[model samples]
Target: MKNSREIIVDILLKVEKEGTYLQLLLKKELDGFESLDKSFITEVATGAMKRQITIDYIINEVSTIKINKMKPFIRNLLRMSVYQLKYLDKIPAHAVIDEAVKLTKKKGYATLTKFVNAVLRNVDRQDIILPDDDLSVKYSIAPWIIDSWSVTYGPVIAEKIANELSANRAKVSARINTLKTTKTDLINFLVNESVIPLPGNIYPDEYLYLNGVNDIASMKSFAEGLFTIQDESAGIVSHVVNPLAGEYILDLCSAPGGKSTHLAQLSQNQANIISTDIFEHKIDLVKKNASRLGAGSICAELYDEKDIDKFVGRFDKVLIDVPCSGLGLLKRKPDINFNRNEYHIAQINATQKSIAKTAASFLKPGGSLVYSTCTLNKTENELMVDYISALGLVPDCTLIDYVPDMFKEFVSGGHVTIFPFVANTDGFFIAKFKK
Candidate 1:
């Protein structure tokens, strides 16, 4: 069996070669590991992934062979090792070097052990000097991302966003399934199960900030439809919709059904909701989540855009959590930093416009529609808001009145962009309109 460090190297290499998501890969690699080992693996792998560019910059400063020229195995092995030497203050330097050397020998690169050892030692001894002009190298974000954010938001705020996203160990937040259990009852149940539950910064009554629960899906409470994992910022979107009992709602592009399930609970499981996704597998995910959360009122369906005429003018509220560049999710999904680019953003922006046009068409006259994305880009956010407004739907400024007081400062003109640094949540944008 492979040890933790070997698993870390494998996770990093797969991310680079296969373009897989870091979190998903890490989860798959973590089964059967002890709790402490799982924690260590999670920390080092995610830390290394988040700081890839920075780690590479430091490696190139010390090694004769730049990171790009090294074999994939050697490059990733050095990357994870260097991450420990530079970032993890608790680990002894000798231990990190010893493990790297042993892994090189075990992986059949015995000849390169000395090379790995010398580079890691040099990395430890070298003075870390980051570029003053390039925030991307320092913050470990893609250059275009940093530059675009700097132009959209000021350089200072953009730097702040980069620094915050680069930071490790994002908190996990979950909402109680009201249909299955009350908040008080769920808290008692979680306490007995050895999971620590704290009040959330926003919606403290409904959401709990969870800790010490490594594998939430394996818990009996989760299987019993007691709660669903969601970020606090994502939970806020359902509040913006403010669905009431007996209202008809359409959640276009709902998958794994976070907001759709929340809307069902918000409306006392009385609102008629149709959760639709383009893929059959994703629709199955929505169905599974809805069933698990006791949100049986939610109807999951395969969405065919060509058959749009049936959904037109049929709902009281429409939610299009449109697919985005996922720039806002850097802290949780570090692979996004490596995978996304400007050209991809432009392509997704057109898809966002198309989805919004369809979502607007779903609402009845005077019905409300909420357009949201977990990305921070203007082209996918503010510009898309304008495009929807041009469709003759007026911006519903009253959405601000429902926003929690903690997030009120971020709201302007009834639209809010929750920056990770400022709002302490995923970087998200939301705007509401009436058809």
Candidate 2:
């Protein structure tokens, strides 16, 4: 039987080579292994990615060759070994080095096994001097990002945010479907399975840090549609939308239906929701979520921006959760930082503006329109709100000021910017407007 470290290194190599999501690939591979539990596997995968920069830096300092010049597999191997040494406590230090050396030997690099063992042992002896307080060097985030965030949020806040992004693992949160079960009832049910559901401070129905459960999909409550997995910030959108019963609502770019279905739930399934996405496959996904959650009033559709004239002024409320650079979700998807650049940011901003403009056209006079994205970029968030306001359709100032208490800290320039570090949720931006 292979140890978890060996298997994780193999999976990491495959992820780097194939350009797959490290988290997803790790989940699939670890789930297939009979001996390992979800918690242990999650720790290994996330630990490696979170400390990637520090691990690489240490490897470069110790290795005879430059770090980037090394093969992807060898680099990932070094990363996995260092993660075990520096982060994981249950795995003995000797076992960590032993497994890594074995892996190198098995790969026909028998000559390098001694070198691998020597490097790890040296690391254990504290030969590598890790920068203790340097923000960019310690947190493994790019220096430019640190500078940008510092300018926007100040030095202390920026450092905190960067540290949080590089922190261990994120908590899993789920909202109880009040349309189906009370929060009390849901908590009681989970408690029976050795899971303790804690109340989320921001939302009345959300639960955080529930123990003893790994995959929510396998839970009876999830299968019965009594709850849905959603970030605390994401769960805030439906409340902000504040859909009323018997109203005609449109959810543009509603795929996976997290917000759209929540809107129906808020309306007690009485509101008529026309959920549309550009992709046909995503329409089905929305429909599936609607059915499972018992939100029959939602009608999923495949739509194009050019066809908006047909449904002009038809909805009393319109929700446009437009796509953007996704800067807000760096903690959840660290690879985005490596892949995103100024050019991609500019392109995404243009698309977001276009989407907001088109969605605004469907709002009936005196109707509400909510523009949102899972990004913190000002160009996509505040600027889009400004563009819509310039169209002579300003947001309801009274309603905008009446943001929930949990998000009051983020209400700047009449828009909500939810930082994962500040809010203990995913990075999100939401603004409510009216015709």
Candidate 3:
């Protein structure tokens, strides 16, 4: 078996050269490893990716070779080794250098092993200086993202968002499945299982922080459909829409069924919900989640744009959690920060507006329409609200009493912008309206 360090270097090389998502690539490479080994690879790989700019900065300052000019393998090997040496204090510096040298020789680059050893050995991590004035490089986020956010939130707040995004451990939140069990019941079960779970500050009744749990899905409570993994921000959208017992709810862009199944579970599996996505395979995922959670009322479908005709004026609440730049979720999915560009954000904004417009026709007069995104871009959040309002929907124009009192300052024009650094939740924007 390849040691953990070698496997991490191989995965980081692919991530740099081929552009695979960090989590997806790690998951593929880590199959069947003991949990401890998997955890170590996850740390170093994600750490290196999250702090790509800073690691590259440290390497460039020390090495004669420019980062871009080196072979992909050598560059990634140095990047990972440097990340551990600088960030991982538990592992002694000599041990990190030793493993990196061995891995370099085994990759058929025996000639360069000493070269690797020399650079790592001589470079003093403390001497490395990050570009303090250049917020983009300091945080390893693309300049466009920093520029866009800085334009709205100002430079300081933008840097704060970037710092939160670069944080190593992303918080995990889950929702109790009310269909099969109560929140109190689920909490008791979790405690009995030796996993320390606590209610979330935002949505205490429904969402729980997975405090001491490492592998959540493997828990017996999870296997029994007692809860499902969901971020607190995403979990709150179901409450914003607030389906009553038999109301019809439509999630126009539902996929992987997080919001759709939550709505079903919230209604005790009695609400009528049609959860559809643009793709067939994603709809299959919704089906799988609905079945596993026993949310039988959630009907998953391969969406047909023409189906809008059938759904028109037929639902009580509609959730257009249309996709956006996903800037809000950067902390949880660090690869997202690297994946998006200016054109991609514009393209997704157009698509988001298009979906919100179409979803409104599905709501009856006076029916609630919750427009939301895991994004901070105003063009996609507040401006989209304006477009939907012009479509004859009336904005609620007040913060719901249940919204975390802490975000009172951000509650403007009936919408809330939750920043990860500010709210300790995934960055999210939510707007409620009545058609």
Best by lDDT: 1
Worst 10 residues of 1 by lDDT: 163-172
Worst 10 residues of 3 by lDDT: 397-406
State the lDDT of candidate 3 residue by residue for 134-233, as single tens digits. Answer: 8877888777888988998888888888888776357778788888888888889989988788778687887788777767668898888888888887
Q: Say which candidate scores most in TM-score.
A: 1
In model 3, what is the error at residue 46, expressed in angstroms?
1.0
Judge candidate 1 at residue 244 and give its lDDT: 91
Tell me the spans in candidate 1 whose CA falls farther than 4 Å from its real position.
none
Which ten-residue region of model 2 has the weakest summed lDDT? 395-404
Cα-based lDDT at residue 115, candidate 2: 76
RMSD of each: 1.6, 2.3, 2.0
Estimate, for each residue in 221-267, the C-alpha lDDT of model 2 and write its tens digit.
78888888887778777877888988999999899899998898888
Global CA lDDT computed for model 3 = 0.83
C-alpha RMSD (angstroms) for model 1: 1.6
Residue 242's C-alpha lDDT in candidate 3? 81
Q: Write the per-residue lDDT of candidate 1 for residues 29-81, one digit (tens) a residue.
A: 99999989998999999999999999999999989998999999999999999
For all predicted structures, in order, the TM-scores are 0.96, 0.92, 0.94
Off by over 4 Å in 2: 1-3, 35-38, 127-129, 399-402
